[model samples]
Target chain A: MEDNGRTARKRAQILEAARPVFLRNGYVGASMDEVAALASVSKQTVYKHFTDKEQLFTSIIMDTTAQVEGLTKMITATLDDDGDLARDLRALARGFLGAIMEPELLRLRRLVMAEAERFPDLGRTWYERGFERSLKTLAAAFGRLGERGVLRLDDPELAAEHFVGLLLWIPVNKAMFRGGNDLYAEADLDRLAEAAAGAFLRAYASPDTA
Target chain B: MEDNGRTARKRAQILEAARPVFLRNGYVGASMDEVAALASVSKQTVYKHFTDKEQLFTSIIMDTTAQVEGLTKMITATLDDDGDLARDLRALARGFLGAIMEPELLRLRRLVMAEAERFPDLGRTWYERGFERSLKTLAAAFGRLGERGVLRLDDPELAAEHFVGLLLWIPVNKAMFRGGNDLYAEADLDRLAEAAAGAFLRAYASPDTA
Candidate 1:
């Protein structure tokens, strides 16, 4: 490995700084000067690595997937590890919900969503890096679960989408509308995990009929 | 009966004028001058009716609801008359989906959701007028269906939430990020509606093993 840890660290700092500016000002409104000031880096340093604002945003989103890719590896690895499926699913839900709710992450999403009319490619990139990567992790987990005779599912991908949809939608949508900040607390998360897991079992689990 | 027809029409005109400007310039950025100019009314005329920007916006939103409320009533009434549950649901879904995708409505929604962080009351107004009202309609329909023995449900409210969640989440979220210009065509709408209704039944229909 080429010890580029310092460079990685700087890049992380820049990305973190850029996120709020992009969120507050949206894509077309945000300026490099504000991002540089927030990151405490010189404008020359900011441009040295990224070619443009789009490229900088593209990098920040890629960072999101890098994180997803790591967790995905472990989620797949644990499919046969004797972990409770509900626990595993809950952990995955927690991860997904947490990712979607990060203030910077939420703002990043809003910025793309808000600017999507004028900037389709930004939304496309964010979706490709964020949601698609998470879907793959869930799909892999479902495939492994089916193979282990724990469940029967014809389309693992759709099942994954449904499961993840439960994890997100309500809390995330409410947050998008400014209604769920206090609602997603610890008990709320537990309720979400239970509701999602129970409903999932009701639809897919073999007739234990419990 | 107080017709108030001209007053209603003038209010409608004001809302139509206000919605686009608010979408383009955001809540704080938009000015009454632009709203008045767009409405073809004098700035004095604008102020004569609504006292301030907040009240003006609230009245515009309420008036918009009074107008757009007809779509839901039309859909629900048509479904109430006669049709298979699944077919009726599909038709309602198509109508509902189409209405939301209207360019002007989509833009308005984004403006409300975007500025929801700063002015929370606007977001609450949106939920009260839009999402909550929609959810309540679904619950009422399902409640009637349950009583008629066409369906079985303990909580139609959650079921309604789930149904709305599925239909609205993907396309609406996509629109939130990408604008609603190229949503499903007729054939796509049919397929989506059928799929949604089918998936919903698979989970909620009464136990047939009896």
Candidate 2:
């Protein structure tokens, strides 16, 4: 029974170790041996848990889908609470920045970007898990904004895409891509989120709307 | 005289061949021998023309810079023409779309983005040359918009960033990043450009301040 418990724990450890290796090495550069070594598991054990690199990486990203979930759920509820628009947006931005800034998530994004050329499937998965889902959550927020009459938007979905598009370059420059200016400090984050939300409201808010 | 002419011609060929090779292999993945072979020049001649790989890439990007110049120059002149904001902005968006669609430039952008992780200098150069310069041009256009009193003013630079930021993601995903979207045909360019411009103008134009 103790040995069975140990095996279960070992399987989880291997999966966790595989995440960084795949992120750091990408698809082509990464190897199973390195992941096993990192996990302190035998080669056969890795095979038992994951049939292939793609499977392992896909599971890695999906399992960590929890990372973005907290921010999404938090913002959706907060955006509904009728807090000030600028304040709400800044809070939302902090959540987003905090989530992406985690060393693990940052590495995951880098790995997806690096391997995007050869194994575009990984990039698509990352986009689906990260951007697509986030956009849906954001659209829900916009829907609330519409209901509040703070903005009259014909299509919250397109508006959400436009809003999130502004931030795509932000992460690309600051973290994964490197050599982008320093990551945002607290004040910088506050300023950018406010400016962005303000501009978005100004542009999208129907004249008679919010 | 014959040898000198042949050498100059060979140098041009090497640069030309380099675009395709660099696009496919990435900066580090590319090799001089392959470039020499593709150019139909001796390795010695390739070396004679470029001191090293970095110089070679810089030269290729410099060549690409010329391609970006004419479009913006035309837009700036058109924007300055009695502040014809509509025509000017339409032309600018079309120009941007046209620039974004060019196959070679698109490939160069992807190559730079992919290789940027390992080579931070390339990312800086790309941002300075491609992103910053383009922003400056847009700011000037917005300055003209303000001069015409069609728009209210804060920071023209930030306004310009927002303007371009709106359309930046689509082509980047389609052409450069290969995120699996069909490229827009030439016929739809102006229409697509105009819609985005109109949406932008609505948010931006100071209550029909014109």
CAPRI quality band, candidate 1: acceptable
lDDT of 1 by residue, B123-157 (tens): 77776777678668778877777776676677787
Model 1 Cα lDDT, one tens digit per residue, A17-108: 98777767666678999999999999988998788998897677566656667657666765557677666666666666666677656655
After TM-score superposition, the amount by which residue B190's alpha carbon in candidate 1 deviates from its true location, in angstroms, is: 1.7
Locate the minimum summed-lDDT window of 10 residues in model 1 chain B. B201-210
Q: What value of lDDT does candidate 1 attain over all alpha carbons?
A: 0.69
Q: Per-residue lDDT of A31-137 in model 2, one digit per residue for the tens?
A: 99999999988898898878887788777876776666776887688678876776776677666656656666655655555555666665666676765787789
Computed on C-alphas against the true complex, the DockQ of each candidate is: 0.42, 0.40
Best candidate according to TM-score: 2
lDDT of each: 0.69, 0.69
